[model samples]
Target: MADSVIEESDYIPGKDELDWGYEEGAEWGLLFPEANGDNQSPINLNSREARYDPGLLDVGLTPNYVVCRDCEVVNDGHTVRIMLKSKSVVTGGPLPSDHEYELHEVRFHWGKENQRGSEHTVNFKAFPMELHLIHWNSTLFNSVEDAMGKKNGILIIALFVQVGKEHLGLKAVTEVLQDLQYKVTHIQHMIQQYTVIFIFVLQIEEFRRLRSHVKGAELLEGNDGMLGDNFRPTQPLSDRVVRAAFQ
Candidate 1:
């Protein structure tokens, strides 16, 4: 919302200090159907802080384009891909090579539902469509659903987009969706669906100073509470999908 990611303050905030809208949203964009994810912030096993490193994320580098797929935010004529990871290209890293997780596709989000759709979850709240840097835990977990069983199977960073102004930087994603025909249009895009992503973090100081300006602060009160009521924390969606798709 503030165009900033969370900075680690040695001191955690009071309940008041904590509100909805994690800064990581700006680091990535939205979650679409075509990709796997790496949501490491909320359940940080390696770091004691349990948050994403703002310094290690770059919003522009994640999914920069989206094809018009008519899934959630995508239409049918456009394509989007993030060209941010220079290190991966240089070393040709598969990324998180340790776990065998990979990048998939990118999408969009908003403050209002259907008005928006998102990837990550925080306190049971989902945003319009927060981008998910989705990844799989290759070692112990066979699939993304299986990994959600462990505390470390998946890593999702939840970022909230404010409602006052248009996200100009996000326009590239929206414009392409516009060019495509709605309701069964065929869009083409080259979003890298592979393993590994190189993230560039934002400065925490910039976020702490700017949090005051983000609009639509009712996230926890509105969407989050509703989600907590629907499912068990970290429960597998396999049962749900299987039941729905087949039944």
Candidate 2:
């Protein structure tokens, strides 16, 4: 039995060795103890229940992004990830003023059908897809590796994708998904203007107007093999509080 033990050196973070699937995520806690934690993510966002925090409204969510030329789109088995090479940061809003979270990577979560792709639901309703912009606390740590598992280490801005006309901002990235329709495949590509995409999605007015339609899965029709429904199921909120900027 001693030969069956897995060594730490052989472990790769974010690389699932157990071949876990979305339907089997409930069992993830068995292998990943953190998955069982009370603060686990992808909780349903209840619009009516979320407390309106004036602090978030007063400070506002601010992003400082620049045009990035050195970026790559990677299909890392589970999802398609856009690895950002340039330094971009977000401050204010729900985050503590003392720390600035630096943007690291962006990931997409989609579904097999148009009705249920998003991980977090609004009033028990699911969107067609979701986009996650992941950031790490750069003020306290040198890199994401050093910030892992720490309090206030990571910040994720999740955007729900609705069916609508083609989104020009997403064209560059979605077009590249065809080439990365295989596991672990990657391509060096510029993610358009990072500032334009982020600002466009973050603004409530702009987002609402642009939500009437998007190419949705039509653009990714034939690449279902690698891009299969990759969303995680919502975890229990437990004792955590979800605050919103709007009342």
The superposed Cα distance between candidate 2 and the true structure at residue 231, in angstroms, equals 1.4
Per-residue lDDT of 56-166 in model 2, one digit per residue for the tens?
567776898876689998776666678999899999766777789888888776665667777778888987677877788899898887766567776777788776555
Q: What would the per-residue lDDT of candidate 1 be over residues 84-174, giving only the tens digit for each residue?
A: 2211111112223344333232322222233323333444454333443434344546655565435444433334443333444444444
Model 2 misses residue 125 by how many Å? 0.5
Off by over 4 Å in 2: 1-18, 194-226
Residue 39 displacement in candidate 1 (angstroms): 14
Clash totals for all models, in order?
A: 42, 5
Clashes of 2: 5
The C-alpha local distance difference test score for the whole of candidate 2 amounts to 0.63
- What candidate 1 gets wrong by more than 4 Å, as runs, is 1-97, 109-129, 137-155, 164-168, 189-247
Name the best candidate (by TM-score). Answer: 2
Error of 1 at 136 (Å): 3.4
